[model samples]
Target: MRLLVMLTCLLAGCLAEKPHPCESPPLLTGALTVSTQNEKLWTYTRFMYDALGQRIRLMELGTYENKSFSHDVLALFREATMYEISYHNRTCKKKPLKTDFQPLAIPKDATLLGQAVLGSSSGPGQGLLVNTWTGDLPGKAGKYMNTVTEFGCIPIATSYQTSEFGWAVTSFFNNVIGIEDPGLLNPPDFCPDAEMMDSKVEPIDFLSLFHGKA
Candidate 1:
């Protein structure tokens, strides 16, 4: 177990198997384009600010194939983006510690994506409606086609100083590209690492994240 943790500290720019799942919901506040061999989907989850590093509003639009799915404003997260996350070390089982949110940064295509919802519909009450009929169909309802939809889609610990922990994190953060591993079939070590070195986000400039909040 100790050996496993040591390996993670030594390796970066790739994935490593983390024992634990995401302890908290992802702090999503930007645009995400998810594509597979079958189809492509673009999602724009609108985000508003509560404070410097906190979020207040929430809204989203997902487009799969040609149909569109708009999401309702459900909940808000305060300082999750800025708060440090400490849980079971996913890469190494023996290590127990907390890591801060990689200071949010601006996405590369910030200007094009963050500007508006692309390929989206402007329909009213455009979100989903949950209507289940056991034996009868509701009065004011129309039939719809298509039920199945295609999918998606992090990182990781980063210490301020290398000496802060057993391993040093000269830089710790993730980019929106290539952040998934399927298990032993595809270990984190095999997956590529986070991209914050050539990134434009500063360690403390949280609002700048509003640009690449994905």
Candidate 2:
């Protein structure tokens, strides 16, 4: 009888579910390395994200077509506008930003794939716990797998595929909790004289902009 009771307790413990982590914070600053299969491109980017203000800014340095290029992009989702600026040439382009804002949180419908610790776990608090989730993008646009910290829900890595842009993997690092400089979200001074591009085109995949497609 004692053996049966012990077995039942162990089983219950094994079956217990872990608590869900909180969604990502509204404001964040981070650096991410992005690689795209179709473009055979690699980009190092530092980003400032302000979910409350519906804005994001990216400073990207990358190699494309066997040459180095750098740009800064300011995306204003609320205004449906994007500004791409090249400080090297003192040029800027203002175009329609058709992509909607996607929060950092895992979707409600995401399937939990697995969980693991990211570093040594020989002692208490020795490593970071993370969860992996997979899901189809809305409207069947693509598929994505994300790994995020279990406690803070901060993204650690993401791999996704889209029909238009193919596959891309982004690894996040040096993430800070809040935006330190609100001015980072502002377009450069040259943006005021930016060329105004036509707005009659179809919506583009947001990632494509990084590939120099925009």
Candidate 3:
């Protein structure tokens, strides 16, 4: 279950947009692509955000050996809650999950790779930032090399390679930011057994994000 949470966070984080002040709001929606060296393992993701810069929805659809599965996540940041509905073997179970919606800080050891224009389906911008770092991934032994890219202070891409794994995983965010539909913020009725999971994460000041240049 925690693995699923981390996956969603990494996928969604790669597409995170600069946090906006409460007075001025914006919405973001886009598809996320996750791929690895071995073609057999991959995922297709879609995520949505509300005006407050909170992630409202994230869905991951995957196909393996001609079979498919999905993970649907719905979040209520104001209520400090998260829901995860997972599908496997044609069955789905909804569980309460824990998370901090606040932006994750870049590790101090990460080396800035200089800023440049990152052109992609997510749009081209001159201020896109990139950094390289080495760190231990969750639930994985040893350290890995990671490269992170950001636009408007929000991460737009992340890639990592580890010697032990013999493969690299890369995630990309397709830029699609605009006004979001209010109805999409609500959780789907299909997931009825959502329960809260215990966690000790703390929230950060969202407005202060992007204060310094990358």
- How far off is residue 13 in model 1, in Å? 31
**lDDT per residue (tens digit) for residues 1-214 in model 1:** 9998988777852564422211122343333322222333444544432223333332345555557765422111332223211123332111111223332332222221111222343775453221111111123232211111111112222212111122222111222332132121121341133222322434433221222222
Q: What is every candidate's alpha-carbon RMSD to the true fold?
A: 25.1, 3.2, 15.9
If scored against the real structure, what TM-score would every candidate get?
Answer: 0.20, 0.85, 0.50
Candidate 2 regions exceeding 4 Å error are 1-22, 88-90, 193-195, 200-203
- Looking at candidate 1, the ten consecutive residues that score lowest on lDDT are 144-153
lDDT of 3: 0.50
Q: In model 3, how large is the Cα lDDT of residue 37?
A: 57
Badly placed stretches (over 4 Å) of model 1 are 1-40, 50-53, 65-67, 78-103, 106-214
Segments in model 3 whose C-alpha atoms lie over 4 Å from true places: 1-27, 37-40, 50-56, 64-66, 75-92, 98-105, 115-151, 161-168, 189-214
The candidate maximizing lDDT is 2
On the 0 to 100 scale, the lDDT of residue 134 in model 2 is 89
Residue-level lDDT of model 3, residues 1-214, one tens digit each, is 9999999999898996642211112566777665555554456777676747465676777654345656565666666555554444323333333345633335544444444454444655435555444555545644444444543334455555544224545454674656456665666555454444333333322111111000
Clashing pairs in 2: none
lDDT of 2 by residue, 166-201 (tens): 788999999999999998688877787776687665
lDDT of 2: 0.83
lDDT of 2 at 107: 85
Worst 10 residues of 2 by lDDT: 200-209
